[model samples]
Target: MKFQAEACTTSVGGPRWERRLAIERRRAENHARRGRRTFRLSRIFSLKTAVKLFLKLSRLQARGEANARRPIIRRVSFSFPNLPTSFDGFRILHLSDFHFDGEAARAVMIRDMLRGVESDLCVLTGDYLADYFDPLGRVYCNLATVLSGVRAQYGTVGILGNNDHSEFVQRFSDLGVRMLVNDGFELGIKGESIWIAGVDDPNTFECEDVAGAMRGASSGAFKLLLAHSPEVAREAVEADVHLYVCGHTHGGQMCVPVLGPLFLNASCPRRFGSGAWRYKTMQGYTTTGLGTSAIPARFNCPPEAAIIELRRAR
Candidate 1:
């Protein structure tokens, strides 16, 4: 009887042990399934977060406000003490890359920016229109009207960029912008003689003759060169230009916060992407430009018009 009881107990104990093991296995599988589900949910949440951030940035840019405020017009001022007395304290309002479309509001915004600028000369670097040809002549005509309204003591001078084709060239000329293509002209500031030279787009559709532009320039006279791309800085320096004004890189168009411009399209080093850069005796000022390109959006790098004041160095 005791042997029979022992056999029964052994059989009952074996079945209970197997049942417990099966239960533990099922619990472990359920736990693993829950972990996988949690991980998937986490990934989904992260992706949603990234999408939300992108959307927020897009909304902010479209609203024309990055930080809950209207886009502030950036005013960059620079003083060059090495300027000659003839053009002492010559203030030049430099504007570039006005990619005007049929947007009336944009024109008004640009006009507002130019409203209170008091300068001796207005120099439009290039990239005046986004249109390939003068497809929208009305837009360019309106732009010229707004540009003509700017008050400058000397006058407004402009050059043709890669974007400005024959049609734009004519329209700009009609607007009273002295379009210089591999040409040099003299301007008198306070009875002091200075040379203003401009070259056509080098990398694009125009002939760039640095030598031709500076042919008649006097060595002693203050030389200001307007070449759209800062890539010509080396040539400008070799030509012994005092100041080189350009606006092609657009400060890399888009830049990361604090880290600044990611890439500069010009041949110059990335450090020369924006603001003022000095190579030997030549000073090159590359404006961030007044418009957008490729992406039509700006972050960290804002559109700007600079006022450069030249003064004789002590």
Candidate 2:
């Protein structure tokens, strides 16, 4: 369903200047991607390129590519003491890192998975596109097709990731996904309510202000934080957020047998890399993601979309 901004109360959390700074930061990152610095500054590091080349030479690229198309529906449950009774059994459809332009089959897989899935809320943690240089028209067209399959009760909301550009905020908003940039909306049920706030890219852009994002919410409300990466876990905890959801690591994208992911690309601890973990009083879940990044492949780590059920702790 199309999410109407005015359907619920919204918090203009951060100041306009903060958003301006974030846009400028994104523009600078974009500028860095245009020249000889492109390979060095972007997600396409020499290591990832080398890994891709190795996979191609060893005939393992095809298997990894196949794995990318086969995403799993992960079911996770969390019980929170502050969670309102009305929100009990609330199912959150958490999708992230679509990288829509990467693989055509992934889109089809997502459409199939979302067919009968029902949720009270849907949150997209970002990395909607695979490459910064990809043509916007085709990329967004593919994205629109993928998003058309989503069915949620409250509606879908998203935040930007490192790979996303500033323009996508409006782009996603146009497509019925409310783009939260250091802002949020309140979901109310019979006078009981919770706040869903999202911050800008904290990993690459580093412009997130957790307290600013929680501006309009009450002190005791169950605050749900949406960030691109787990990098802001500590900040969310400091802001008194009850839950934090994000995705950027892609569950290591390419992992080994027991050693796990070779590179998480996230600043937080390894425990918070790709799944649910607790930080002080706040609980967070980082999805493995639905698509691959840097190199279009997956190893032992399969792609996934999370269906998180929130229960009020007795």
Mark the regions of model 1 whose C-alpha exceeds 4 Å error after superposition.
1-82, 131-134
Error of 2 at 190 (Å): 1.8
**What TM value does model 2 have?**
0.89
User: Number of clashing residue pairs in every model?
Assistant: 2, 0
Clashes of 2: 0
Highest lDDT: give the candidate number.
2
lDDT of 2: 0.83
Give lDDT tens digits, candidate 1, residues 5-98: 1221111123323443454466558766774245566655664346446757668556433421123445454445556677767788888877
Candidate 1 backbone collisions, by pair: 81-312, 81-313
Residue runs of model 2 more than 4 Å from their true location after superposition: 5-45, 102-105
